[model samples]
Target: MIFGKKRFPGAVADFEKAVRAQDGDAAQEAFARLHRAAAKAGDGELREAGPRLATLLPSVPHGPRAAVAVVIGACVERGADVSACAPGILAGARETFALAADFCARWADTGGGELPDPDDELTEEIIERAGYEPAVGWFTLPQWEMASVAVLNDPAVRRESAGTAELLALVERVAEASDHEFRCLAYALRVLDDEPLVVLHRDTGTGYALRMSGIGDNFQLHTLLAGVLIGGKHLPGQAPSPQEIAVCRDAPGQVETVGSFNLVGPDGTWIFNEGTPTDIPVIDGARLLVLDPPPYRRAWPAGRFFPGMRGDLVLDRVLDAAETAAWFAKVQPAKR
Candidate 1:
């Protein structure tokens, strides 16, 4: 157990004390100190509490969850023998209430639950592959789940009113696309709530708008644009291969062709402003694509405000990069 009854109770006690003090600033400071100590604990008493800490994580609220996640991440970062605890840590961080509820209930019954057998060998591989970092790991789990849940709740895209199957598929596809699955999930989450979409570039002379989706998810824009550029005459579900994506990206402006650009619904209903017609095949479910520019342009000048959380400056940083575009394209659905 990482933080059993007999070990490292002082750290947990100090954290709980600060939390009960009702002073947000002091609690934040306490969390910071806890993280520092956990990171430096190495193979000391705090390190010994790893397994217990994993099961203990889910029973707490958001603030302590953040602190505990940091401690677990620090253990993983330092290559500690936390193999027995990783699954619980991940489940706690992710709020798998079905799995964690029993752990929490049991903790309430007896100060700690039975330590699960260590699977550190496999869990360590998963953590390393996901690039777990103490700084971001804690925040990423809940945030990523939030983003995925929002997409499922979106009426236009929901496969069913419940949307559970669609949500799981979304998570799986996103993980497959990203080198760091958790990091990608957090990025996806932020864009859903905070950065929906914005016109990153506009033509002053023509009054045309070129918008990009905020964060890369199934509805990401870059892949659709690349598919249009390379697979011009194909219809109904042809996506660009990586090599083809590269070709389209290398010269995006040059690939602009005769067909209209669109953001379409699952039913083929247009979401974005309509564009010009052409020989390009209409992909019935294409969510975000560009063949031609949008008819309306932003009234404001370039670099002007968009009346949202993110500024044009932030959009510029994300949209203008080839690597970002590549990553975004990977997360988007191949067909729609």
Candidate 2:
């Protein structure tokens, strides 16, 4: 519309200018405008701008990179072909914008639900050779169990037993590597036989939890948290189910039940309570609360929703506030 170019093109120009100026705030605002412009642009305009927008991703500042990636994801969601952006996205898979990059990659791969049939001739041949019948649609329970056990028992997989000391060391390493931007709180739960539970509270106000079950070594720990940080899932585990709480006001009685949690990564697997709620010892824990940042900031969308309970379900009313706070005060920081 301006200078013979459409709104999208104009917005792209503004974004490019902001990037050139190395202005983080301006870049963020420009990216937002670009997203709006893309939404209003026609399908033809989107297709034409897709590749150009992708090329700008690498030049975006770290603080605003995720925002830019979201714009690209929006374009892809609108049916724009931005497959060319995959390489840059994969390059930054470990960076802060990982979740958005993952969303873009997934959208490109599935075209938002058009995936290739998994039960093709090659798959059937492999199934026959493995002495397993080809499943018509989904994996049967027995098949799934067998596969899971096989993966668990694989020789290449790495597993380690970690105690309190090793856990502290791992947390310190992750914090140092992320320059303390990756803030989280760890707790040692007595109910789970003293397993360490890590709750990552991001600057975006999004939170995620991982229970360290003395599984894999530090590398696995990094990978697990990294996937969680970006709101993506590179592992498999049981999804979280709601727990039932009972209250009897007249009788002045209350019953608390055990909840389930699981995480399976390349190196290790963790299963807690097996997705069932049962009567057990009261759930009490000492806090290893490390960094507590204000819970208000940018909103980052998860590329793949990890199977876990909401923060309130995982923590609220379960832990004694006074006791936990006292324990947190007594805890010392892990030595570097």
- What are the lDDT figures for the candidates, one per model? 0.36, 0.35
| Tens-digit lDDT string for candidate 1 (1-336) | 443333345565565566565555665665566655554454555555555555555544553565565565455434434454444443443443222233333333544434222122324433333223421332244533432333322222222223343334444443443222443333333233222222211111111122333323322233434254325442333444544333222322222222223443323334432121111122322222223243442121111011111211122222344533432342333233
Given candidate 1, what's the lDDT at residue 26?
Answer: 62
Candidate No. with top lDDT: 1
Model 2 Cα lDDT, one tens digit per residue, 10-126: 778788888888787887777777777665777666656655667887786443454555555445444555345433432332232222223323434443443223223325543
Show where candidate 2 strays beyond 4 Å: 1-6, 97-336
**For model 1, where is the 10-residue window of minimal lDDT?**
300-309
